[model samples]
Target chain A: MTITVAIDCMGGDHGPAVTVPAALAFVRDTPDASVVLVGQEDVLRKYVGAADLPRVTLRHASQIIGMDESPSLALRNKKDSSMRVAIDLVRHGEADACVSAGNTGALMAISRFVLKMLPGIDRPAICASLPTQSGHTHVLDLGANVDCSPEHLLQFGIMGASLVGAIEHNDRPTVGILNIGEEEIKGNDVVKRAADLLRDSGLNFIGNVEGDGLYKGEAEVVVCDGFVGNVALKTSEGLAQMLAFFLRQEFGRNMLTRLIAVLALPVLKRFKNRLDHRRYNGACLLGLKGIVVKSHGSADAFSYGFAIARAADAVRTGVLARIAERVAQGQTQPEPA
Target chain B: MTITVAIDCMGGDHGPAVTVPAALAFVRDTPDASVVLVGQEDVLRKYVGAADLPRVTLRHASQIIGMDESPSLALRNKKDSSMRVAIDLVRHGEADACVSAGNTGALMAISRFVLKMLPGIDRPAICASLPTQSGHTHVLDLGANVDCSPEHLLQFGIMGASLVGAIEHNDRPTVGILNIGEEEIKGNDVVKRAADLLRDSGLNFIGNVEGDGLYKGEAEVVVCDGFVGNVALKTSEGLAQMLAFFLRQEFGRNMLTRLIAVLALPVLKRFKNRLDHRRYNGACLLGLKGIVVKSHGSADAFSYGFAIARAADAVRTGVLARIAERVAQGQTQPEPA
Candidate 1:
């Protein structure tokens, strides 16, 4: 029942301050789960004092890759950095998965380089769990590959559906191809071609889902190219922040509005709680041999804990194996030229 | 200088019920402007009784294109349809511009066919004015061509800048190439290539802006290919609607929440008004030799009136000439091979 996750303590905006406390909290909550904190020994000891929890382990990594470091530079030089070493744990069978909140480009590059891709997957896709109206919809290829062909999109769908089925226990999850319009012939050549593949892939392929469908809970797994996925993800974040800013400004405008705000503070709190991005902070890096979940770089201990929990859940549910099996099945059918 | 706009009264989800009343209201408000309502004579007269207004004119057409018809089918068969006849007004110089709330694909195809592309422009991008934190940001290629080259993106920046300059009175609008990350080396080859062209094109290139940048008002003009743009736009709409639904469900959960909702009514009203998508309707079909504006298909009288105003403003400020001139200037500079 033991599931171990390698934690990149030197990643993200807050680095060890956020990741270490989260690692402590996560292992405490999940009794059967343990975390390997990968960072410098001296710095790691500052947070994990007395080693009270037997589930906690500190693995020494010689270097640290910065939050803003270029992927090329980070991959080229920081070979022994926490981000790389943490992912190495999964590759070497020391840990079930690795969780990082570092530079996305660096993490993707290092993970792909060290762990390698699955047999049928050409490139690893960044899969993030996003909240939809009904429940959570797993969206993939967030930003791993900007220019994706139809095959890459098809692979993303396979991985996403597998992850959801294994973790959520949804045997037949609907996969939606994100397009401009819901019609079959609405998108560019790549999307149309991807649609044909998804339709015949034996999965529950729901036709095209438009941009709005991402939030409307039209599908369990929404597949798109990295460029579109990234834009949609970021745009949603930016909009949420803007809405919060506007609310604050409006409440502070005049004495009447301010007094009304006090009366409605409880409802406002409830509303804010419903839309908090942190609640859905954890996203998986799909199509890789090992399970890799990405936490938002700016995530606080609360959100980072969720990310750690997410990685552990994937390991417990055997998502990686499910994806590999599904992928192999998909690859058996010849790809259209 | 009197400006005339040809309105396709039989287009959109609401058809004549929305467009006719919207046109009448627009002419009543704008003294120097008139609208030509294009549709079957009987249907047009049903909405516009007695034709009492001197600023109004009814132009009859032989056919009406359905909303769900394919773009190719609509273009080939419905040549004398209301939508095509309305566009013909601009083509024959009978009206300064055309406004329609038709099928987006059909509208784009017909507009391009009838008006022709501006010199140096390869495609017509759908540009809409989005309300940001400060004022408004103009985004282009909403859903015209799903696949675009680097040169198309470069041209979008040029066209967007000229539109802002002519309409908003800002000579040099800051343009941001939409990408997943703000870094120079973040996006795919297409975006990277587009970034290079934008940086060297002598416009106010403000580097890359992420998805959230669209709402944060980071740039006055945000450029992306049609596929990404459409997804971003629809995702925003979907997110906003979902937020609204969640708010309603929360408020209706119990008596306390409903009481708080009553108290927070004013603030909620103000907040909704600020983020109302209706205030920012009527996206222009840019890069066309003549002007064509597309309103939301399900627009009400108030929003459709705004669409009419948008068209008149474009005609008044000479948006088409400015775009054509700037495009020619950009074309004169040797493109990077």
Candidate 2:
């Protein structure tokens, strides 16, 4: 199966400098995959180089959305934006999937507006893989729906499970509700109701998992409302950044510590590599009719390639089909309000 | 003023083995402070030694509350538990504050039931200081109230500011609402309403703060519903543990790395010291008529002593009086339902 991904080359902090190279590298690495680099032809052409790679193609897009632009404004005004054009490619079935390192809100809004929601899905959710002790766990609704209902949470569980089933090739991934405690009596009314719905659902429902369970790999897929998930995700980022800063400050404190840092550089580098955030760069915008993955807006070429690879994997593994099928089976029926 | 803190000696994972030593060490370090150890008198006497320290005393309690017991069950049945007796001492004016390394739910429930809420406050909150880039930021409502109103959040902001004022001596500490973003339009309705209330609150309101801003030290105090706060705190712990595990695994991968690890041990130890979780062990149960601090159940003597110091500091600085005065001033009037 030849998986083609539409790349928003003009998006992200580095624009074409990061996205174009990442696209070329992705195509070079995967013989069964191709990428359509969508951006201002003039700018992207300069980075595309003299060697004409058959697997890599360029599509012209006149407008570019700023990283900090309002999502609504970008969705309404920037029709020819690389982000929109990339999603348009997926909508028209020109590409199997779309990937962008653009503004998350804008990408989400534009994707929803263009490709529309998948059948039986109310709102699309942002799903991303987080590094864990055993391997990694997929967490959904990182920042999509701030106020989610129990039905929405139930939907997130189904979509998340389908995502793991497709990507990890696991038919029944352990799904858990993100709560304050693992007990049934824990959490607010919505979570309690969602737990009931999940328990009845045919998926491998593991009940409630605490915050620490996310990194402990207690479940293959952890589902939460966007507000909670976003806070958890960003808080982790903040902590990791603070720890890194402290590590650098301590190692550079004095001459004696500096000497030890020099000797320990190799081991430190290896350790850093094992926990590299780049390895988990792509965040899948799940529950959409077509596959859409959002890369970090500040991602570099090497990091952005992971996003491309994720989009390709979703396409090849038929994640969208699995979600539709799961929902169609009527296993995720919500309780009447 | 000499402050008196009642210690729940039978609480925590180690019971008297940890709490007894911690109480003794606390009185030794804090000359102006005294501790009344509440637990099985015979069991604690064995650990208290024959010194008969002038500042240390023992109060016998027949029962012990299990760490895993339900909060409501412990509150009703374990009224004679060491946890209850310690709080009772504070209620009876024998002690100015109380410290416990016990079940957090039980501590909060029992504290609220015994000490009661301060005038004009509906519910209590759990406030704890987290290490940040510049210094530290105090966050409140960490698993106390899973669901909170805008009014409750405003109360939390007020209480957190008061705690910071008492502990850090900052009367006008920058206060912020924890949200997915720093923008006015970010977060759920409660957060948005809370932001508006905070703006008119006559306090040092700094508007919305993102998760990364917590570690960046953008605000001295950040307030949120207990659900969000607890998830953020526990998620950070999980990530830190995972990173530590990864670091150890990388260093022990091969003999060459092991030699480098030995050479770099001192620097690594210093780095670890700067990021020690034990340094921020105590969490203040704010909005109560009396001061109560909860220590980590797994804390050692040195770590648990911090909780004792926290309670003593709260008493010495008159944190309870400050919060009551602030609330009595009618600065936190909630909107009618």
Candidate 3:
């Protein structure tokens, strides 16, 4: 029942500077959890403070994956890299879960290659938790398999539903296929096929959800292929930033405008955070054999710490075991021919 | 030159309620411009006042295309419909340009079929005026062709550049292709091919632009496939709405926040309008033989008027004719194999 969290200490923009301290904070904050910081020992010590003195085990690794390095090459060449070693620890039962903010492609590939997928899972889906107007919604297949089959989308729905149930505490969370329109006959072949499969499945399929649905909590779980999902997610981020930038420009137009902006500081800050990408930094690589969390590479300490808690919650809820059992039991409802 | 604008009075959510008054106001304000209101006479007169109506003509039509009607079917069945008749006016030299807030798909198809594409133009692109931090950026192929080839994208870039030059007064605006990354070697096959094509073209091609660049004013013209453009545009709209919704929620959370919101009202209003899609509602169907403008279906009177102005601007600049000349001259720059 002991919770051991493996951390990729040399992964993000700040590398060990942010990752090592955050790992120590997580171990200190969570009484029942033990942390294994994966990186070169000499570098890890440089960032860790005296007060944070090696309370956690330091695992040595010779290589560090660059942020822009090719995903496959980084994983293949740097076999003992922090990212791969951390996932490997989870695969060998040395860690309860693995966390990294490295190159998303590398982390996803390494996790899938090392721990493998759960039974009935075609591929590992990346599910990001979005802070919606209503509450929180799970958006999946962010960039795992750019080209996905209807079956893969259906699996995404099931895994997303399961993850939301365990993490967000939404029982039987509604599942939706992202589409250009809500009609059953709307989207492309891929979307139509996914909708058909979802309809047949006994999961609480809520039909199609558009891009707006992701932020308004139109459904608890929104599923799509990696290509569409990646575009949708990045586009949303670009838009939020754009609006914020526009607000700043309008406010700086004149002296009176600057005064007005000062008065609305509190309200604007709240709005900024509500629409902030930083708040939705952590993502879960679901349908895998073990829990593997991925945070935004540019995430600060607060969000990085939150990712640790997210990972711990998933492990405690037995999310992976439940998915494996359901997948192994072959109880998925079949679509009519 | 007579700046006659033919409006499909049957289009839009409110239709004549928004379009008629807007047209009346435009005639009153502009003084020199003329308008031809194409729709059922009864519906048209109900919205437009007979007295003091300066240079306004109402053309009767028997059919109207509903939002849910199939694009091809509407064009075939509703031959003398308001939308069709309006475009016909431009085709037959009775009007300088045409405007419709109707079904976008139908408009693109009908315009291509009726007016025909300019010579040398492989594909016609839809160009929408978008408000950016710097001012306004022209984004094209917003939703005209969902599935596109590298060649089609190259056409979009060329057409978008020409449209921006005519409408925005940029002689040779900076052009950039939308992609996942900015590097020349980055993105899928389609993007790399388009980049090679653009580079050889000797247009002020600025290479690739990421999602974040759309609102940052990285380039005056941002060209993308219809599928990606549609998602990007819709995602931006959804995110802006979501941010505003969340801001209102936060403002109403407490009394102090509400007071702060009131004090910030002036700057907030400016900020809101800066991101208002309505201001940039109209999109020109570029590469066609005649000028055709499409406005948002949900636009109000003010938005409809702005759309009319947009249509007039395109006609005044002879943008369509210039595009046709470029195509006819076979002036396309060859790309490296």
Candidate 4:
């Protein structure tokens, strides 16, 4: 099986400085893997080595989605943008999958517009691989569909379950709906309806998982709408940073505390690495016609490399095909919605 | 001024085992602060001390709200529940304010029912202090009202802004709506509607704030629907646990990494303290006719003490009176259906 990943060269906070080298590193690491660098040839060449440059194909894209541009406008007008072109590579079968650290909204929009939704799939949900206390869990619809129906949430459960299966190697993943509490009749009307649909969907549905359960990794798949999902993802990121900042302040409080910190050095280092976003850099937008993985915007070379590797992993694991099969067979329908 | 805190002794994960000691500790620490422990006399006496318990008062109540009970059902049926009695103390001016580390849904439901909403207030919003990259930011509506209107969010902004004034001492706090992006035009229909309303309402609106910005303390007042706020709060809690787990695993990795960990000890402890929920354990249910505060169920005596302190802060700062004035002055508009 061949895996070719389309890289958006002109994406992210640092652009080609991070994306180009990351792509090269990924290809070098995986000798058999192929990658297409989509951006202006001149800009991309600066980051790639001349000796081994030809190994990575450079696809010219005239348009580039600005960080500030409206997603709908960019998707509609910037048809040949780097992000769109890279997504097109997967749609056209030129690449097995696509990866980008671009505008998340634009990436999601293009993935849906170009690659289209999987058969019988009402919407494509974005699943973020988050590190948790127990291990790791997959959080879905991290800003894909703003409004979701009970059936849509059920579909997310199926897709999230399948994705978690591929990543966590759990044949029947435990699925949970993100809610304030762990009750059958909690949350708003939508969440309540979704819980009912999920419980009867024939999946290994765990009752509702509260916020604390997320880190416990009690459920492999945690499902919610884009708005909530996005909020969850951001809140996690914010808290992580907050903790890091606070830790520094506490350590610096006095000489005695500083010495204690030094004695506990090894433990602290290990802890920081576990919470590092780089370890789980790439997130796959599931239920699309093809694989489209998003890396964090502020990700460095190592993180971007992980995103490329994640795209390759998705292709290797045949996530899209499994989703297609699931959708095609109408196996994703909720028992009752 | 003497501070009297009404504590729901029957509420929490371990009930009186945790709440009783926590209340005693608060009174011991703050000489002027007194506590009214509300619960059945027998259960209250099991945890309450005899000698130094002079500052503490017991208010007997036979009913209790089970954690699994629906918010509406518990609020309606458990009229004499300890949570209700604790809140009633604040309503009747028997206590300056109230604190409960129990079922969140039940607390919100009962608090709103007994305490009532301020004049011109459509709903009472739950505002929690979240650890951010910057010191602190208050994210509101963390499960007060699930189905929120634009006006509800606007009210949240007003209440949250006043909270910043009271706590952070910010003259006119910057308010931001929780969205996937920082742009004014981004987000779903609800966010867009809320943004439009906030912009016109004549507050210190700062457009939309993404999840990542929460820790950055970009906005002193962060507003969202109860559902989104609750998810965000839970996600932060989950992420913190996940990071802590990862750090422990990393610390146990090997000898070489262990050496680096030693040098980074001070920084790590500071980080943990900065993100610790204990530092900001209590959140006010804004727009209530009287002050009501909710504490984390898993709160230790220290955190419960902080909850009592927080309630005192709200009362001393006259937050409810300020909110009543803001609502009456027509600073925020009505929600459009």
Candidate 5:
């Protein structure tokens, strides 16, 4: 089946400069995919030209939201903004999914208001992919609901497992709740309660997994409250950036070291290519009625392109449909006595 | 004045094999330091000869706490265990501080039971130093308390600031609360309330910092609840290890790449040293009545040596005294109207 994705052309730091090129590259790679670019008509036309661009359509919108805009303020005001317009396209069935690299708070708020929540889901979670020694692991609630209840965490587990199962073609995915320690009695009240609920939730629930478990491939899906997940994700990025900075400084310390650096350039390039974050840039805003993918605000063409691909992949794999089916089945399950 | 440190010789994964050599190296490096090695007599004597060891004295203890034992079981049952006995030496004023590489829960549980909390401090925090781009940033509550109230976080800032001020020779060290975002209205209720307290508590409070703030050197001491801090710390470690693994895998891929790896060996060594967590291995159990430094359970001889040096440094710098003074002074301040 042909897949269509709505692109927020005026979102993020570089806006159309980044989004336009990424959209072109994405559609070029997918034979049966098209993109609906949302932004100001005059401004977007400057980039796309008057000629018929292959598999691309431009939709006009009046307002633009700043990267640092207040989410509530942007919500009440900017109904015609590119971000809102893109999500609206999905709601209207003009596109199967929408991808935006904008203010995260603004994007989530607008998407929730426009698309609403799926059945049996109180709040949507931010689901992202991280690299592991064995392969890849999916983590949810990266920053959407900062103060998640135990119930919210359990719902996140279901949504995350569904997303992975749909996209990765794994029928039964292992779910692990993230905690401070691996023991049964290690976590705070929320995690402990969530663990109890998960144990009886009828899913393939493993016990508690610590922070290292995410990278060690202990489970396919790791669930945590948004506050903890955001900190973990950011810390990993910070540490990786620091290591790269130090490596550059060490290589440039002296003339001999610089010569060694020249000889080691190929190896360093290969190493960097293998760990390049752009390859894992896209993250789905799960539990929403329609598919919404949030790209890194500072993502370049490469990462933004991957985000476009991610939106199509989610649509093609029917991730949102699978989550809806599971939630429906969960509602029919007997309530705990 | 000479500082005598109590060393838990039977603690950690390697037990006496790691701690014994580390204690000797520590004494050799410090001019006015002595150690009381506490463990089983036979096991301790195997590592340390029957002859008199310079600046090292063996104190026989009959029990050893397993790494996976229940904290309460170890605390209530094993009073004369190596970890507990070492802390007792400090409690009785026979040693200035204690160092252990044992199970963290057991260490914190035992230490709190032996050395009560300082006045006005409801809980003790685990404070660890992390490698940052500028140099190093200190982060607290790494795994001590999983659940924390707003008041506890405010107290953590006070204690963390005091520790950094005393040890780093800065009278007023900057303190940053870790949160999901930098905005004033961006975090959970607990963090928002804690921010309010920090604003008027008279500390050098900068605004909230995201995870990247720890590595960017935004603050000298980063404060958070133990759960969030532990996740951040462990995620950093896991990411670093994964990057290292990828680098190794890339370098050994082919013969030409392996030759480039041989040339880049010196640069690689410096990179490892700069980002080495061992250099910043020791973490303080702050707000305690006396100093207690906790080393990594898997720490090698060099890291264990650093832990010993950390205990002595905390004693010499009067870290406990400073925290006590701040806590007492804080009690005199009137509650918010």
Candidate 6:
């Protein structure tokens, strides 16, 4: 099946300078994939090569959304924005999925308004893959639903499990709730009630997984309220940046240490490549009627390609269909008391 | 005045093996500080040296609290446990403060029951200093009150600011509410309301701080509900561990890299020392009428010594009095609408 992904070429820090080239490279590399570059026609035209015309299509979008623009304001004002146009393609079935390196709040808000939500799903969650010791773990509600109910968390668990099952080809993925402790008695009222519902949800519930366990790859899918998940995700980023700074400072302290840094450069580079955040750039807006993936706002061409690839993978693997089916099945099951 | 800190010598993973020696070393090094070791007499006697006797006192407690025991059960059943005895020492004026490396929940419950809350403060918060780019930032409610009201968060800000003021000698520390975004509209209802309350508060209230801002040292004190704080802390720990593991794995990949690892050992060691968790081992249990500090359960002697020193610092700086004064002042001021 040929998967077509819509790209918001005018979004993110670099605009078409990063997105257009990323889209061209994506279609060139993936034989079974095509891309629609959505932005102002005159601006994006300069970035696309004439040789790549067969698989690349240019769709005009007159307006642009600022990285710091309010989500609600952008939704109401920028009707023809690259971000909105990209999602509109997915809604109109012109594209199988959409990828944008834009403001996360704006992307989420626009996608939800355009694509709507899947049946039986009360809210859309921002699900993203994070690097772990074993491999990677998919955590949901990164910043989409700040306040989530027990039933919403249950839906997240179901949607997350379905996403993992579809993408990893694993029939049964281990699902766990992120909590302060592994014990059932731990956490607040919402977390405790969510745990009870998940226990009887018929998924491969692995009980509570602590914050550290997320990196340990203790579960395939970790569910949390957006408030907690967003903090966890951003905290990890801040810590990684600080550690890198410390390493540089230590290595550059004096003449002897500087020599040692040169000798160890290859190993350090390899270590960095193994845990590169660029490899995990795409974040899925789960539970939407159509697929929309968000890339980091500061992502460059190389990292943006990963986000486009992720959207294509979702389309090829039928992740949206899988999630819809799971939610439908969950609605039939009696609610957990 | 000489500060006296009661030590729970029979607590933590290593029990007397780690805690007793740490207490002895602490008193030996600190000229104006003494420790009253609370534990089984037989277990702690072997660890204390003759030279440490002048500044150390052994106060025998017959029972012990297991590390994984339920908090309520431990609080009610283990009245004679070393953990309880240490808090009891502070409550009865036998010691100016107390330090424990026991189960956190048990310590909080026992401390609250014994010392009671300071006037106008609803609950205790776990405040700990984390390594940041500039120095360190003190984050509070790490795991004490998982679900916090806006008023509870406002109280936490007051208490955290007071603690920083006492310890760091900074009377007007900048405080920020932890949120997913820096915008006023970001986060759930509690955090938004808390930000409003903080703005109207008498303290130096900076606006919303993102997760990454915590390590950036954007604010001196970052206040959040216990659930978010706990997850952020543990998530940082997990990421740090993973990075360390990846570094080791890469360095030991082959004979050439192994040789390079030897050359890079000094630089690597210095980097490790700069970010050592031992230097930040103690978490202050704030809002209690008396000062109580908690050490990491898996801390070694060197790390546990920091917790003892922290308790001494708290007592000498009169942190409890500072918090009481701040809360009382807050009560007199009109509540934020």
Docking class of 6: high
lDDT of 1 by residue, A1-337 (tens): 8999999999999989999999998888888999999999799899888565688889999999987788889999998999999999999999999999998889989988999998978998888878788877889889888888899888888888889999989877999999998777789999999999888887788989998999989999999988899999999998888888888888878998899888777777888888888888888998888989899999999999989989998999999899988887764343334
Instruction: Show where candidate 2 strays beyond 4 Å.
Output: A50-52, A332-337, B332-337
Q: Where is model 1 more than 4 Å wrong at Cα? A: A50-52, A331-337, B331-337
Indicate which candidate wins on DockQ. Answer: 6
Flag clash pairs in model 3: none
Residue range A52-82, candidate 5, lDDT tens digits: 7888999998999999999999999999999
The all-Cα superposition gives candidate 2 an RMSD in Å to the true structure of 3.2
Residue-by-residue lDDT tens digits, candidate 2, B1-337 = 7888999999999999999998988888888989999999999989997568888999999999998899999999998999999999999999999999999899999999999999889998999999999999999989999999999999998888878887778878899999998678879999999999898888789998888899999999999999999999999999989988988898898998899889878888988887788988999999998989999899998899888888888888889888888889887444334
Per-prediction DockQ comes to 0.80, 0.81, 0.55, 0.55, 0.77, 0.86
Worst 10 residues of 4 chain A by lDDT: A328-337
DockQ of 3: 0.55
The 10 consecutive residues of candidate 5 chain B with the worst lDDT sum are B328-337
Two-chain complex of model 2, DockQ on C-alpha atoms against the true structure: 0.81
Candidate 1 chain B minimal-lDDT segment of 10 residues = B328-337
Better of 3 and 4 by TM-score: 3
Report lDDT (CA) for all predictions: 0.89, 0.91, 0.82, 0.82, 0.90, 0.91
Candidate 1: tens digits of C-alpha lDDT, residues B1-337: 9999999999999999999999998888889999999999898898889646788998899898888898899999999899999999999999999999989889989999888999889999999988777777999889998888999999999999999999989888899999988778788888899999898888888989899999889999999999999999999999988888888888777998888788778888898999888888999999999999999998998888888899999999999989988887763434335
Which stretches in model 4 have alpha-carbon errors above 4 Å? A49-54, A167-169, A249-269, A332-337, B49-53, B72-77, B167-169, B249-271, B332-337
Per-residue lDDT of B172 in model 4: 76
- Which ranges of candidate 6 are over 4 A from the true structure? A49-52, A331-337, B49-52, B331-337
Q: Give candidate 2's fnat, 2 decimals.
A: 0.82
Task: Please write out the lDDT profile of model 3 over residues A1-337, one tens digit for every residue.
Answer: 6689999989988888888778888888888898999999888878774344534888988899998888889867989899999999999999999899898878988888899878789899899987777787888888777668899999998888878777656657899988876656557777798898888787789998877777778889999877667777776776677677777888888998888778778877777766667667778999889999998888887778878888988898888876776566563644224
| lDDT by residue (tens digit), candidate 2, A240-272 | 999989889988989988998898888888878
